[model samples]
Target: MTTDTIITARGLTKTFTVRKAVVEAVTDLDLDVQRGELVAFLGPNGAGKSTSLRMLTTLLPPTSGTATVVGHDIARDPAGVRRRIGYIGQGTSAGHNQRVRDELLSQGAFYGMGRRAAATRADELLESLDLAPLATRKVLGLSGGQKRRLDIALGLIHSPELLFLDEPSTGLDPQSRANLWQHILDLRREHGTTIFVTTHFLEEADLFAERVLVMDHGRMIADDTAGNLKTTLAGDVITLGFASEADARAAAARAGGTAAGSSLSLTVDHGELVLPRLLRELDSVTSATLRQPTLDDVFLALTGRSLREDAATSKEEINA
Candidate 1:
């Protein structure tokens, strides 16, 4: 690992033996996370995102390969990794019965902090996370957003340099999600904290994450800044209307539609199908609209399915 590298994984693979067969959560993975980078793990549900995160955090042992997180080997330096990183999972962990401020102070005490320091840190986090006004209320009595803020504060109580958040905005409302991301950005900017976060929201990755890693079916499909990925698209997806598929193809051919079929149409990878390009290529074309490609478009192009379908699939599955 290099000096500036904070997390390094080599051929990481994970599998579970539920009964007679093996379920591979992650397969032959390699990852390099530089210090202080907010890397977003972008994938559909059960795409080994949470599993990979859990393994790296030393919460679960990997089936194969090695990782060094925060300059410590995962296999041999689990304790060191634990000491250097803070993990906030999907479920709410703080006791619902206890007052929020008390819970934060107790977490600090668990980290061996003095009472005065713990109190000070609790108050500081309360203010930072917008929890100061509700500091004395029991977590159960708090709203979903407030509890989530409390959870984040608890995770940061020890001031760990690396923070792992798994679906931080999973069930949050739009306003709460916005609040959570604001604090996340602030944490990274103010403290230079390295963040490794996983989320199913493509918009979240597009807007907030410094780098987006697109994963599908347990394999990485695309990894880059969202803009570059859009630029890489085939020269504008041209959807044209015609009396028939052949007419559409004929029109597309005039406008660089090498693979045009029917009104469905086609274009180069990450191509910008703008009004200018359309007008230059196909004057015969009648109505056309320009649309900016999104991370969802990237996901669909790679996974062959919309993200909504993936989310809906996991939600609709019946229990065993």
Candidate 2:
């Protein structure tokens, strides 16, 4: 492994049996994550985002394949991997009965810190995550967002080099979610922490992560910078409105575009390069517009389904 590589996996696979039916949660996943990089893993439910994370964090052993996390083999040295990484799962990991500061100190103790060192670390995390005021409050008395912050502080007590966050903002209100993101970004900037996060919020992933990985049906479908994926896979959509339906059809045929009513639409790799030529070639063109693609459009183009819709439907199916 390279010195800069924080995570390396080869053909990582996991399977489960539910009601005598075989289910492949993750299949043949190969991944590499470098130091100090923030990456987002995005997919609908049952897309293996959590399964893959569990394997890398050593919470769930992979059925096949192998991986090394933070320079330690996941199978052979789970303790070493655990020591070097912090994991905040979907549910809050803080103890309900303990005081916020006590819980943080306990986490530090688990990592084998001296009492004074643990207390110092706990105070630092409490201040950093905006939990200093609530340090003396019982964990059970805190609000949802406060509890979530405590969970993050617990994870960071050891100051691991890498942090794995599984849906950290899932249950937060809009303002709280925004606050959490700011803290996460600040952690990366100040501590040079490598963040590997999985979130259902497409917009957050698009806006925050340096790189995005899209998984579907237990397989990784796309991996690239969000801007590159949108531009390369989905492209820019150019629409031209003609004077009449017949004119639109004629112009579409000449331009090799799709015709609808009085409009002709074509997706081009570079809309600016093609727009002027299209205007000159199509005499009946009245109005022309070019639209940039979003990460949602990229997902739709790759999987033939909207990720937002898939996520909602999957949730409903599970509840039913």
Best by TM-score: 2
- Tens digit of lDDT per residue, candidate 2, span 1-320? 12399999999999888779878888999999999999999999878999999999999999999999999999999999998999998887988899999998889999999999999999998888889999999989999999998889988999999999998998899999999999999999988999999987899999999899999888999999998998889999999998899999998778887999999899988788899999887878899999988888989999999998998888621110
lDDT accuracy of residue 265 in candidate 2: 95
Worst 10 residues of 2 by lDDT: 311-320
Candidate 1, residues 88-154, lDDT tens digits: the string is 9888969979999999988998878999999999999999888999988888898898889998999
Pairs that collide in candidate 1 are 233-269, 233-270, 233-271, 234-268, 234-269, 234-270, 234-271, 235-268, 236-271, 245-262
Winner by lDDT? 2
- Give each model a TM-score: 0.88, 0.92
Superposed model 2: Cα runs more than 4 Å off: 1-3, 253-255, 272-288, 316-320
Error of 2 at 227 (Å): 1.8
lDDT of 1: 0.81
